[model samples]
Target chain A: MQLDATDRQLIDLYQRDLPVCDRPFLDVSRQLGITEEEVIGRLQSLQDHQVVSRVGPVFEHSRAGASLLAAVAAPEQQLDLVAARINRAPGVNHNYAREHTYNLWFVMTAPDETVLEERLGELEQQLRLPMLRLPMVEGYHIDLGFEIDWEALP
Target chain B: MSTCTSPSDNGSTLDEQDRKLVLATQAGLPLVSDPWGALGQQLGMDHEDVLSRFQRMQETGAIRRVAAVPDHYKLGYRFNGMTVWDVRDDAIAEMGQRVGELPFVSHCYRRPRHLPYWNYNLFAMVHGTSRDEVEAKAGQIRKLLGATSAGDTILYSSAILKKTGLRLRKEKATS
Candidate 1:
């Protein structure tokens, strides 16, 4: 979709969360010199368009909780079925088909470890596949949230 | 302060700017005096509109989080692994709640275990600043879950790789 200058401006604001306040949109509207309604209208447009995925508390993984990225190997024909099965499971945030031995891969997050194991066991039997749990061993960072294929401007 | 919200009824599809919003905010808003102000200036929109819209989007379910990405490897315990286990039915959800609370375990969930190399379930990511720290944490998990046997592969992230948020857009059908 072609992005107009104003749309780009709106998006830039979306990228940056509104201030933490009683009326964040109102605060933002005040800053940008636009009505709070306009702010809501544009965001509604962006979301209706599917440009934004989620917006909530940026949980500090290191400070408070934890998470992991892992994958599984599945026959090509069963990829769809397997993916659907995996995706159906609770706590399964995102899944990707990598060009590797592990054809099916996904990320999971939860409030706590006992949960991980019990569920892993159930998943194996339920989906009937070996869910290779390859968590991050060492990393300066573990978030794969960026645009993998974004072509930076020259 | 307000519960996050989304614009579920707007019905407008995502464009490039919207995509950029997902990408930029996926990581988390920067820690600054006027983070939204900066973002509005960059996008050329009124900050209030952006703020209100974000609140609305989060209030709805379309957008999931504005979570902080922590520096786990830096902090003491270092080893990280994708610990997969075999669990019984009717107990999976109960177990997930348990695993999610561990300070060391960053991620936990259930996924499909295909077969052969994949026959494990219940996944969790444990982070330690050190390898031994990671093992100790994993051992703690084993005790908590009561698994007969378990497996974990250490994914030493070779690189930082890609880190961004996803914004799924609907493509109009072509006649």
Candidate 2:
């Protein structure tokens, strides 16, 4: 999808620290010197194009609940079936197929550590593969908010 | 006005009201002139209260930031790589922070090294418009790690099977 100047500017500017106010869009419009309607319209359009996933708060999972990244090496023949089963578990939120021996990777979050382990154990038994539970020990660089110089990068 | 002055004030333990607010905005804030006001109406709180509470949440590191999360793929970042490094345990803290500061690296964390099978202790996620671009970014990290990194691997994601923001559920509901 091609991005216009406003689209790029809005994305770069609003990626972090959106104003918290009654008329947040109005404040943004004032900064960009665009109308509030235009600001809202561009965001809506960006979302429609799937460029902007959403405008909201990114919650801290560990604080909100207990979460861990777990992976299993599904046999090539049963990759789809295994992945489907893993996804069915409510605790499993993000699941991905990465190129590696431990191919099926996912993140599971539960109310507490005990439940998290139980769910992971169940997945291991059902999938018939040893699940590698890699819990987060610490975060080194946590701020994902990037100052995307879109024009600079290809 | 309780502003979270320290990073330690992580909004982990939430009251009923806090949970309701988090649940309401999990999808995304509505695009309206008075989003907080609308939210307040839904939660039966004043707009000012909603704004103040949310600000505190951000200050506490419970909320990373209130912003537009751009889908990298839609923004032309087609390739994504999970770059793992087997850095010396003693040097990982310093090295991981350095690798994470690189603009292209999104998430950098120190996870348990499940060995004989998994040896990488430090994981960093890098995104690029092409595979070459991603590899080049990883190369920069390798250069940064220098000899401290025993080895490294870049796992390119082939598919995103499922992705949903983590939602907290109350009670001992076994899955």
What's the residue-level lDDT of B65 in candidate 2? 81
The lDDT per prediction is 0.52, 0.84
Number of the top lDDT candidate = 2
The TM-score of candidate 1's chain A against the true chain A comes to: 0.69
Error of 1 at B28 (Å): 4.8
Estimate, for each residue in A47-87, the C-alpha lDDT of model 2 and write its tens digit.
88888999888888777768999989998889999999999
Ten residues in sequence with the least summed lDDT for candidate 2 chain B: B166-175
lDDT of 2: 0.84
Error of 2 at B67 (Å): 0.6
lDDT of model 1 at residue A30? 78
Q: Is the docking of candidate 1 incorrect, acceptable, medium or high quality?
A: incorrect
What candidate 1 gets wrong by more than 4 Å, as runs, is A1-19, A22-154, B1-20, B23-32, B75-77, B147-175
Per residue, candidate 1 scores C-alpha lDDT tens digits across B34-106 of 4566666767766675665455445542343443222333222234465666655456566666766665566
Worst 10 residues of 1 chain B by lDDT: B166-175
TM-score of each: 0.48, 0.92
Which residue runs of candidate 2 sit more than 4 Å off their true CA positions?
A: A143-149, A152-154, B1-9, B170-175
TM-score of chain A by itself in each prediction = 0.69, 0.90
